[model samples]
Target: MIKKFVFTISIPIVLFGCSVTTTPNGKQVDMLPLISDKNRYLIVDDKNLSKAEKLENYSNQLSEFYGKQNSAYIRVLPRPSYQTNDRFTPIPFMVYEIDSNPVKIFENTMFNPNNVRITEYAQHDLRIPIGKHDLIIVNGLGNSRWFTKIDDVNFEKDKKYVIGADVKKGQNAQIFIAEYEIDNRFKVVEPEHFIIKKKIIENIPIGNLKSVKVY
Candidate 1:
């Protein structure tokens, strides 16, 4: 009888000892409220999101958090075709400064949360032309799923903006929204719409060199 009791008690302890994985299937990503760090800025225009299902199978709460056809979580379900020929691992977000020589803002991609990158890069303020620029998102499998050219984007100093991706038609395309506001010093500015972690905002660097030019 004592042996039976001991065996039953041990089961619970063994289960508790197991490590919990924060990432789902090694491909899920927790969406950030401000895709860019506080110092860097970009605003996504308001648009009717192309309604379709994407992350429903993964998380219902996260799907509702986005308030549309997107999720607070993203799963990178990469296909073999996308990895063909050893392509640079597909990043879900990319920005290019429009100029005589368009420069890819690699640092921004490095700093943002991604499934492919192991550790995030040290983030700093972005210095772009502050005019028209191309913001692109390629999901898992290296597919260019969303691309838009936004004009007159205001990336002024000392302000933070919230960017969210709207994946539609089963992840065929995406429309991102950027809502602008004054920096609140790590406070949640728009909780009614979404909640952003204070830690993520403060991690933004108030620095020189502007690692990401928000062109």
Candidate 2:
């Protein structure tokens, strides 16, 4: 039989000094207003900087804590086809973390583009401890897979970070990255919904600068 478990974490007084608000996925929360006057000048709209800031905040919160936590969300898109007249498909997604590895995370069991649909997707959110690790995502059909490494990462208390996936090669394949907010309180907020659209530029042969990453 499949087993299920539920875990709860209480916010501590020291970490609850500031008021916190929650927003739905894809909704942008204003960070400028949350910072103090002295630090407000440092705020800018650089996407990469914003991501790094959130990651740092999250890392600090969970570095000293115990127990694991998670949030769940889904991404829906029309499956891609390598040839005309191919059938539509589904892509299931999830975001999860294990206690033993701090830097590495995983999104297990995804479906490719040609077979993806809203009903075919599922997700789970989990929180665990920090350590070194490996990240892997296996296609449910067992025909394809992706792997990566997560070095030293401290998932902070209440901050969130975004993870993204990209699949440039092979037909009907896709990659997904999810975002999260790790708060000072050491809790995780589900990430926003972002789609990785495919740009079907004609395949260029050797020595094409633009297609180097794709090759």
Local distance difference test, per candidate?
0.29, 0.29
lDDT of 2 by residue, 85-141 (tens): 323332232221233222212111244223222222222223333333333222221
Local accuracy of candidate 1 as per-residue lDDT tens digits, 1-215: 99999999999776544422133224221122213332122212422211111111112322222234411222222222333235554333333222212222222233333212211110111233332333322223232222233333444333334433444564433334343333445433222323332211111111111112111
Candidate 1, residue 24: the lDDT equals: 25
Per-prediction count of colliding residue pairs?
2, 42
Best by TM-score: 1
Model 2's alpha-carbon lDDT is: 0.29
Model 1: lDDT to the true structure = 0.29
| TM-score (C-alpha, index-matched) for candidate 1 | 0.29
| Candidate 1 error regions (>4 Å) | 1-90, 99-101, 104-125, 129-140, 143-147, 168-172, 180-215
